[model samples]
Target: MANVYDAEKKVTVNVLNKEFDLGLMIDSYGNTGFRLNNGVFVMGPMAIFSKSVLCWNVRTVIDITPESLSAFYLLEPKLDILVIGVGNRGDKLSPQTVEYLRSKKLGFEILPSSQACSTFNFLNSEQRYVAAAIIPPTNVALNLDEEFDAGYRRQRNLRLYEE
Candidate 1:
């Protein structure tokens, strides 16, 4: 029988044999927030650039505004794309915010937090100037807990049967 281990899964970016020192890849994310490759866990919303990460103030998609995104706009080396992680369920940005980004000539993609993390990792691996503003998913922690509990129970049952 296969052993079941209740451990946090490691998230990785597949660079396909090319090695690059892409600083600060997102290691993991949960309902609380994100964990960086360097093992630092940041709580709440955040903004991630190629080399650094910053705490973002906005909590929900509706809270996102041009003012809230000042950090991205003022980046010296302008980002090629800005990925917006709009919490658990994907939602469209406000028209005004969309216009603001377009006026700054910043390319953008809006996705659920999980997909946003993947997209950011992929683009960053390619050495593209990419950034991400992500809101922690609302339902992830509860779902993870349920799954972990179920796995633990199954493992315990297997151990009992073996004995």
Candidate 2:
């Protein structure tokens, strides 16, 4: 596997022989946090936007508030959607926070960290005006290969135990 922390880490997508920089693309993630396409490995939770990445103070879904998300509200050009990654499992935000976003006319999607990462990457690739507030999962596979192998092992173990 390539060193995720290497300063040379970059993944580009080609479109008609022209490569575009996916600066906000999440290259990898683990308990510590995420490795971005720009080769910056951010620790702890983070708020990712198209132009910048900020370290978030939130540790759990319960820590999420409109106050915690003040940065998103201040973004220029506005955001089409905000993706909230609620750690290892899917969780709901506080009613107050939900109401706050709605009142601001901000659309959002709450999902597990894993799914949120993928969704954010996809939207970013499409050049959509999107942002993400992510809480790193305490236990997670660092890459797709690891995730697939882990799932396959789990299924095999389950069959063996059942038989």
Candidate 3:
């Protein structure tokens, strides 16, 4: 497993497709959990996520749920895959967790950051299962058009991390 570099300018992270912002992703195989930016973020159902979104109407965001993560893992088209995003914590993914994943017969790759996210995608695009780690929904983000593979949409578009 190669290490994901924190300094790289552009790297792709995925929830469904390639992403330029690392904050919007998490290491999820249906229901996997992760630590991002000092706090923990987990997903549930669209209804619940939607409620959170409605409750926080002051900001722009998306509702992602634990059910979403679990559905991703349990989806019929699932690929036997696993991704570990390592950043906030240096501890090893516990043996219990690894054992549970093994029980599910998942193939695995652990990554340090976005580089690993890209490598996993490039290697497994034909299949479906993929995951990543990230902070939470951010007000600041990279627009899809800017990094969608045709080419960069904006060259010097500097955006701040959302509050």
Ranking by lDDT: 2, 1, 3
Give a tens-digit lDDT track for model 2, residues 118-149: 88888888889999999987655346654465
TM-score of each: 0.74, 0.72, 0.35
Full-model lDDT, candidate 1: 0.76
- Candidate 2: segments with Cα more than 4 A from true spot: 1-20, 141-163
**Tens digit per residue, CA lDDT, model 3, 26-145:** 232121222222233343211111012111111111122232234335645555564543322232445555565566666765444343434444444444444432222211133455
Model 2 weakest lDDT span, ten residues long: 10-19
For candidate 1, list the clashing residue pairs, or say none. Answer: none
Q: Candidate 1: list runs displaced more than 4 Å.
A: 1-20, 141-163
lDDT of 1 by residue, 57-140 (tens): 998889989898878878777889999998877566799988888898889888988788888888998889999999987765
- Return the clash pairs for model 2, or none: none
RMSD of 1: 6.0
Clashes of 1: 0
lDDT value, candidate 3, whole model: 0.34
Clashing pairs in 3: 26-132, 27-132, 30-69, 30-70, 30-73, 43-65, 43-66, 44-65, 44-66
The candidate, 1 or 2, that scores higher on TM-score is: 1
Best by TM-score: 1
